[model samples]
Target: MPETIFRNWTSDLSRDWGKKPIQIDHSLSQNELFSKDALAELIERYPIEHYSLMRTSSRGEEKKIWRRGEVGGLSGHEVMAQIASGGLWLQLRELKLVDKRYHDLLQSIYGEVEQRVPGFDSFNHEMGVLISSPNAKAHYHADLPGQALWQIMGRKRVYIYPAEEPYLPQEELEKIALTGLESALRYDPEFDRHALVLDLEPGQMLTWELNAPHRVENHDELSVSMTTEHWTEEIRREQMLTVANGILRKHFGVSPKRRSTEGAGFWAKAVLQAGWRRSPWYKREQRKMMPVDFRLAPGTSTTIVDIPAYVV
Candidate 1:
């Protein structure tokens, strides 16, 4: 491992950390922990509940398809081979909780960020690994927490848009917060004209403003990347406000006009959201895991066999 995860950190990077879209050089590509062999081993032992194997439509396809599958009896290398054949992606979610080495690495990453950025304290950190096939696309979406993308191998083009208005409407954000569904945000091709598009390569990482809408397309090779999520005090307050506003708009037929984070109104909304969390509706509104509908074929690298769907 290198002495520092970030390779080309500067004063400007620290100054613009999360206020805008920015990309910086990193050293994780050189770490053995991210090597193909190591990642394959991790996948072989990964818990089924902590991973998502998805097949989606290829690039330029008008209809979108997102289906869940399982790795079945294939080895990690075979899974990668199948993914490289195209139209598939795997997300090893919550690596920090699944592996101690990754957990330590996640801690080191945020610790470095806190050291470089003044008064920037973040908690509830999570880290996940993404392995995707060539030409695969991650649909336009917005996340509720602070997010960053780190590329360990291959290349990808990322398009990031402003976090307000038509790109990310208040209602859509509230819906996501209320249901824990990140990919439910509406998208328009025209919005790409106003986006900041950047090609992320090996040893690069990107971070944007909180809740900024973004999408990605992988280049003509298998790609390996890491995604880290965290929450700051301000972000938590914003989420609380979103949930409270969603509840008011959805159930009480009232439109919330206040967006302030520090006032009597904000406190009242915070209490409202807190109370709602303890209610039964909150449990009912949470997103459920998709069922495993298909599995990798036993001998063929890219073949999938449809099976009776069942939730893990």
Candidate 2:
């Protein structure tokens, strides 16, 4: 482990932490845990419920394709090799709960942040490692929690757009809060014109404003990255408001205007959202599991065999 996770921290970085899209140099790429061999070992033993293996469309393709798949009996190295071959990405989610080393690393990263930024306390911290194929693209999406992307290996181009209006409308965010679908936001190619585009390399990490809409495209090489998510009291309150407002608009056919996070309106909406969570409707409306449509071929590195669709 490096003595310092962030390499080029400055007063400006602390000031702009979550207010805008900022990329900073980091030392995690030097950590031995992120080495290809170590990652392969982790993947081999990772719990099925803690990971998501997805196959998506290649770059420049008109039609979009996203399917869930499984690793089957392949070795960890084989899985990495398959991803490197193209059109696939694996997310080892919630690393803190899956591995103790990662749990400690997560704590260390946040501990350093709290030390640098006074009064910025965050909780519900989670980390996921993403291994992606060459020329793979993650379509435009917006997340509810505070997010940061850290590049450990390879390179990727990231486009970050403002977290408002056509890029990330409030209703779209509200729907995500209710349905737990991050990719529900609509995207326009013209939005790229106003986006802050940056190419991320090893040892670099990017953080943007809360709920900012962004997309990623991998260079013609396999990419490895870590994504971190956290929530603060303010963020929790905003989420409550989003859910409550969504319920009003979706279920009751009522439009909510106030977006305050305090006082009577906020408390009332918070209570409403809490009640909605316990209702039968909430259970039915939650995101459904994606069926496993394919599995890695037994001995072939890049071949995937189609399987009878089944939910894991």
Candidate 3:
């Protein structure tokens, strides 16, 4: 069978802008485009391949992973012990293994999103689409690249804090060039951080700066959503450093002295510094980096200028 490469709705937008999060609700204004019936049928037709699931648990004050990999596989049964011990179970890298049929569905809806939003683009498949099982708990984490999350079914509340806060302090953007992002968020979970908790229904979307400190609390019922990565130079650097850190951690007893892009990159870290507290760089960067500026108005188009040559 031949595969279809659908038209790229975001090619123009990708070329002109850098990544930033913007919300667009009416991209699929028609009710039929994202109905509960359509979502349920899709899930039933394409059962998830669970080989990539990873479970993390708390052992006293610290967290640990009890089991990982396939459901019936050796690691899968071992996870039961961790669950009994009250460990958290979750999945990662979902888009990599989803069935091709869903790819068609994504492409179908993606076109409408691009047209209606004016300047949005589809994410790379490696970033994957994520849907939470009922009562799922996603520990606080961030991504290497900016993320766009479109809610297809069910409900979930998301809480986010400003990436840069005075108390949090931006020490050195260069630190990201050095430890990776995941480690940075842990420095201040209790800092005087500003928070926004979102209650999302079907068809709502939230796009935000990558590495922005955030977490998810899903409803007791099913929650289905899709996510994609918008590539950039920073993302490329983040991926390389994350891999480098993993290798060094395995081969040597020492942790890599580089930033991991998993959540909140070095820029967010540096913004924590006292000098940056006085500088205008953070706000200026925010305005310049956001790719699309959209409104609820119908029949509008957006265009960004001077996107770096490297991004796709």
Candidate 4:
């Protein structure tokens, strides 16, 4: 259907699967979903809970997001025209849940990993599509699950940093996993020196260890990328521990010293998080949509209409 999702795998993949950064070749960029017109229509029809649109500044060293929007019946060309001018990013997340092609791709990936890598059996998988204006940036961030970013269209530069200490502090990771904030971290210029930077192109795929810190900058063209996340039992245990430790940090004000995934200590912490997550006190993390403040006029990028109320 797509040549093969994972083009190459090595014995090293078994040992370094979730402990280091790796880039491989894939053919997903040629899929119909990545077509500019097709993508625009999909974003317009996407559910409010699964998609996001943000207005970003074109000029600023800081990635300042000026406003966010809720999608309605915006056409494919209209959305592309807005991005073509270089000021927006649209993230359609949990795409596998909404699209069968994405679902098949993920299943195929897992099958390949299972057949090649040792001790690898993923239980859960989720994927998303990231469409951003030329020159847009993802900002430095880390995800909770084992993650792989499959490049679909356009070119971009990526920087991946270590998952420990200064790059990804424990406190910051806890905050992201528990709160409603964007998957972003406070970035310092010094950290760039240690980053494993890569120039990503269409048909290429890159993945790093679980919770690795990374960021991206798009080239001068409309960009389309697929982000896939999966969790094996071992990875699930790590998540359970991360949440448990977060409870210890935020509730008891204790900075944990050890990162153990199993034992009596681990089980106790797991139960604490499971019970706490089920309790009424734990609020689910959900982002309230920013009002639909602007609309793009047909065939033009700079012309935006200020709406009086939320778009439907």
User: 1 or 2, which is superior by TM-score?
Assistant: 1
Query: Which candidate should be chosen as best, given lDDT against the real structure?
Result: 1
State the local distance difference test value for candidate 2: 0.91
| Residue range 1-312, candidate 3, lDDT tens digits | 432222233544334323344444534323442354543343333332332333434334365433332222223223323322333332334433555554555555555546545455545534344544455566565555666676766678876656554422233222342334443444455642456678876667776765565677667665656665564566555545544444345334455464655555444433334343355643443312112121111111111122222210
lDDT of 1 at 66: 82
Ranking of all predicted structures according to TM-score, beginning with the best and ending with the worst: 1, 2, 4, 3
For each candidate, how many residue pairs have backbone atoms clashing (under 3 Å)?
0, 0, 25, 0
Tell me which residue pairs clash in candidate 2. none
Q: Looking at model 4, how many pairs of residues clash? A: 0
Against the hidden reference, what TM-scores do the models get? 0.96, 0.96, 0.48, 0.90
Order by lDDT, highest first: 1, 2, 4, 3
What is the lDDT, from 0 to 100, of the residue 53 in candidate 3? Answer: 34
Tell how far residue 255 is off in model 4, in angstroms: 2.4
User: Best TM-score goes to which candidate?
Assistant: 1
Report the lDDT of model 2 for residue 91: 97
Question: Deviation in angstroms for 237 in model 1?
Answer: 0.6
Worst 10 residues of 3 by lDDT: 295-304
lDDT values for all models: 0.93, 0.91, 0.45, 0.79
